[model samples]
Target: MQVDSKAIDKFLVELLTEVGTRLREDSIKKMSVATKKNRNDLVTNFDKKTEQFINGEIKQAYPDATIVSEEGYGDLVKDMSGLVFFVDPIDGTMNFVKRGDNFASMIAAYIDGEPLNGAIIDVMDNEIYHGGKEIGLFINDRKIDNPKNLPLVEGLVDVSAPMALANKFAVQDVIKKSSGFRVYGSAGIIFGHLLTGKEVMYMSYLAPWDLAAGRVMCEAAGMSVVSIDDAPINMLESQVVIVGTQKVVSEALKTLKTR
Candidate 1:
């Protein structure tokens, strides 16, 4: 089935905006939280509710779309075959529960294993970063400038906290080579920075929902999206995501090789 990019973009914006509004409203109230895989990995009432709302809306809007979501509110997708929607209702659940500012709501629509539309809403910041292969990258109404091809040493880089702490995949060495390092808990926010060239590179182990939206946005904006080892990213599985300008990617690969 051919996708109407315009309609999908509009629907994405509306869906994300609604989710963001509810997130803001919920932030002021107390939340019910529980541990997922570990104590650090959390799930809140907001996350579950937001996901259920988004999934329900998607089903109503596009009945045939398969939704792959966090919190298990979506389908048991076995392959990236049809129209698949990857959703993370709250990208930074920890931040949403503890700080309520850095979290984001993200969704990406893919057709036949290729990303067609993507949107990430920084709920508290009132920023909506969205775009795809057909529609160009945009922050709300404005189309964003393509990120510069800056090398690692010349620009700031963002890494996952665990990767930085353990120095996994030579992450620490890459940071030392870069101008500096930043650790944002949300991959969506980190990808937002990369989309606008605020940071030269972002490296982390990410799930499908975590990377799906950002991958589309980054690729649409002429940035690189690949594994830390410079391999093709598997959209349906967790992997080490390395996204940035070409130069930054090259520098990062060099640093990783040296370690």
Candidate 2:
């Protein structure tokens, strides 16, 4: 069964907006604590519930679509040849648990191993970034323009601070050359930066759920998303993420020693 990109995009935007609003309402009702998967890793009840809710909806809408999601609400997706949905109930679990403002809900639909449509909802801000192959991207109901070409030293950049501490892939040098660096900890919000051209680039270590929606949306907006080495992203594996304008991406690649 072929999936319609427009239908998928609309469904994801609605689902993300609905669930993200619920998360905010849930937070206002009480102060929720998070459980630790490790020292810095965290999860909350809302995260699990949100994924389950979205997953249930996907099952009803597209029963054959494989789900690869965070928080264990999805199946183990080993193959990427068919239709699949990548869901991240909460992209910044720690930020949601600690700061409660930087997290987001994200979804991406893939057909025949290609990204078809995606949505990223900034739960705290009530902003939705929705895009698909057939139609362009929209923030809320307004269409967004493609970012102008900018040099690495002239635009903002978002990167994970932890990666700098560990010098993972030597991105520190890239940070030094950039105008400035920001770390928001959520792929969805960082994706927002990419959409607006607020940050020319967003780099970090990420999982399938983390980059799924952002990948499709970024590409739709005439941006590029790839690993440090400029390889095709592996949807089933963990990898370094770099999304930016073309120039920023080209310059950032200079600092990637891993390639």
Q: Residues 103-183, candidate 1: write the lDDT tens digits.
A: 899999999998799999999998999989798889998988888888888899998898889888767888998899888
Best by lDDT: 1
Q: What lDDT would each prediction earn against the true structure? A: 0.87, 0.84
Superposed Cα deviation of residue 88, candidate 1 (Å): 0.1
What are the root-mean-square deviations of the candidates from the true structure over C-alphas?
A: 3.0, 2.7
Instruction: Note the clash tally of each candidate.
Output: 0, 0
Model 1 clash count equals 0
- In model 1, how large is the Cα lDDT of residue 205? 84
**lDDT of model 1 at position 152:** 85
| Candidate 2, residue 59: lDDT | 96
Q: Tell me the TM-score of each prediction against the true structure.
A: 0.93, 0.92
